[model samples]
Target: TKSLSSNFIKNIVVEDLASGKVKEIVTRFPPEPNGYLHIGHAKSICLNFELADEFKGRTNLRFDDTNPVKEDVEYVESIKQDVAWLGFEWDGLFFASDYFGEMYDRAVLLIRKGLAYVDDQTPDQIRETRGTLTSPGQDSPHRNRSVDENLDLFARMKAGEFSDGEKVLRAKIDMASPNVNLRDPIIYRVLHAHHHNTGDAWCIYPMYTYAHPLEDAIEGVTHSICTLEFEDQRPFYDWVVRECEMPATPRQYEFARLNLTNTVMSKRKLKLLVDENVVDGWDDPRMPTISGLRRKGYTPDSIRAFCREIGVTRSFGIVDERMLEHFIREDLKLKALRTMAVVQPLKVVITNYPEGQTEWLDAENNSENPDMGHRQIPFSREIYIEQDDFMDNPPPKYFRLFPGNEVRLKHAYFIKCEEVVKDADGNVIELRCTYDPETKSGSGFTGRKVKGTIHWVDASNAVPAKFRLYEPLITEEAEEEGQSFLDHINPNSLQVLDGFVEPAMKEANGGDKFQFFRHGYFNVDPKDSTSDAPVFNRIVSLKSSFEV
Candidate 1:
């Protein structure tokens, strides 16, 4: 119970109970069954389910399936999986289509009471009639239709008597209402597409505004929580519920939706990217989708931590994407095991060590987690180091490798750069380094320190692996507001390279996580990894001076 007190949703419920307005808290996460759930949806799921948990109440997973053209069972199943993966359980599952029959009957009742009418105007004509914010809307010719004629026409419209959009049932509200949404909004439209769950049970379907409130009422939901964009439509939502005389009246509350920086959260924009094959699919690791984040080695705890840290706010705000990366890196720091991987390999020959000779060197699995113990890595005469680790000419701040400069080879002996071998194009082809046998790591040698340390893998004994490096999906922070979101797509978001890893990594199956020494956290890609050749996706980089 104390845990619930920390979340703002619980605080709201406590006030509701203190005021004696509600005996139990009830909430619902209503997602349209149209697209794969993304990281943004995770925020709403945690809020609804966690609030219900705090008050010992129930939360329902409802699909607002009003539009059959864009809805699908595939999306519905993916949403359920994503919610469950986020560590939340729904007390019930429902659909707007379940109340379609009841919703249709309510429309007929409204028409009979002179509260609704059947409009024969085309979609374009209705749009032209509903004026802009500065102008008052004009009434449709069918607005003054008699109650008896309206009822008969609506019933016939549902009985396959009206072509799709040829006729629509609209509420007889004031056309001059400044709110715009309350101006005789359409309650039901004729659509012939087959419903995912309801099938071809009816040719008429209820609009989202008309069915959302009714769905909440039927489920006995006490509080209908939604993003702020729906605030304008709330009046219409409430009107339908009250006129229908539902057994219970559900209240509506609005909060700002999550707007993440450097990423687009709109499903429509994400769909465009998917259709255009900008990335891979909806679950590409570069995507903001929940499944994509999971595959990218993001823990549920990190995501939950991110949401809890931001909490619920009344005003809109953009959360810095770095905050999310910070939590992820923090969570994986002490957990992920450490290994040696050379992404951009360069030959480093330990000339002093015997040729064809190899010795086992002890390396801690995770420096932050000592209890994780240690693993033995092979140290041999020749190894592969990072290409950037060595430089033919050293600058003032370049502490890595240079001719006549010494650096420690991580977990092995300290080596001084004795010579630099070059190629025809003037690229440094190899580093001829001489090792100090007495200055090996853990040898307890006195005053044995190097300016820098670099990671390496024994070339002959190492395993060939694939390294996938990723960057921000968008190059610019906020590209022109009115332009297509894709205009800022980062051309070099992902760069795949053949890399060298320690022999111990050969035993890892797909999905294994590791922190490559001096590199970044990485995970065995669930796709395109096998026993002999592994593909590791860079999870996140280690905190360095660059981040500051």
Candidate 2:
């Protein structure tokens, strides 16, 4: 395993160990089972798992499944797959719901100590009284109920005596606290909704903020790392742990979340896309979800390298999406097999070549790495070149195929276009070319040279395939908090084309990657492709101007 670079979190772990304030380090990747994990979550997963791993400490994969309304077993399984795919093995697998019994006891302890009380206010009334940044919140009407009454009400609320949102348990902290989260934040809410984990075992669920610190404490987590939005909630986090009298005190550290330009990082927005059928599903190649990236042919190594390169910082910034493209290109350049595939085929007839015969031409798998060796590609009297490779009306510097223009066929002989066959509408449909035997590739023929060398596949033995090209699903950026994200949807995000690969490509299994000549690196579509009909998803282009 590669050594992780020193960052602020790593530095803190080092200091904590050296100072003897902590014996052994423990971190947790706590994701709520609401939706499929996104690329942004990848950052956190790397941070938590790798940080503890670097110091030979423990890390846990915990699902904070408090809100039953959005939690699902599907999300839980997807998260487990994503974490494992990222190359992490958690020391412990846990769920916040696993500690529901203990959490309920803690809430009772708070009530008996007069630190928490059951508030019989509506969610709207609580929000209305939750004063602005410049003001202080008003006290709940039931905040001063006798401890005996609160204990009874809280027990009844747990026993299913209350309807959803009819009553909530709130900490009796200062209502005028400058930090809004410390202003008597709700600890428990009566929700009769069925939970994916607990099922009907719980009619009252603890809010995430209230359960998060407790879960960390119960698991002996030394550092509770989270996004910067929780920076304000740190006070309340400590309050719950301290007031609940937990044995272990876990400190929360906030880091800036990843924000990519021209992409939606929010899970809620991503779910909306899936719900509205804007894309295929959670694993649509165009999506920012980790599964989507995986299905789009991204290697785990590339993503991990990217997360490391971005580093751990508390400063907010928007990363250019091209930077992500750059890493995938780097990862696949020498490794991916460079092969010939015509995405948009235009048939060509070799008039002077022998008919009813096929020639296998030698081609290197990767020019940058000779150890990858070479493969023989079929060439014949009839071949398919890209439609864009030929031009009926050529521009001034156009060096590709045209009437009377000779261009070298990649790995084959030099061919000159002699005629362009057209249909009734005058649209060029085919080309008739003549090849010079003396100019056969690797034949030591230096008598002639062509400015253009274009890739082609033998039509007689071509492997039919489907290609899916993807762009950012969101074309522009807007405030997603208010549903303006829909305004930036990119209509041209996905383009599907029927293509043809070399005959040998027909044997490629799903998830196999290849660098098609003149096309981008593509992955065999794992979900839709079959042995007879392969589908390729373009992962990234061959090159980009973006640099590290």
Alpha carbon lDDT of each predicted model: 0.86, 0.92
lDDT of model 1 at position 199: 94
* Model number with the top TM-score: 2
Candidate 1, 234-328: lDDT as tens digits: 99888988888788989888878888888878788788889999988887788898877877778888898888777776688888887788878
- What is the TM-score (0 to 1) of candidate 1? 0.95
Candidate number of the best lDDT: 2
The per-prediction tally of clashing pairs is 0, 0
Candidate 2 backbone collisions, by pair:
none
- The window of 10 residues in a row where model 2 has the poorest summed lDDT is 1-10
Off by over 4 Å in 1: 1-9, 477-482, 544-548
TM-score of 2: 0.97
Q: Which residue pairs come into collision in candidate 1?
A: none
C-alpha TM-scores of all predictions: 0.95, 0.97
Candidate 2 residue lDDT tens string, 1-548: 22335257888899999999898999999999999999999999999988888889999999999999999999999999999998999999999999999999999999999999999999889888988789999998888999999999999998999999999999999988888888888999998898998889999999999999999999999999999999999999999999999999999999999999888999999999999999999999998999999999998988888888888888999988887888888889889999999999999999999989887889999999999999998888999999999998899889999999999998899999999999999988999999998998999999967899999999999989999998888877876666677878888899999989999988899899999988989999999998789899999987778887
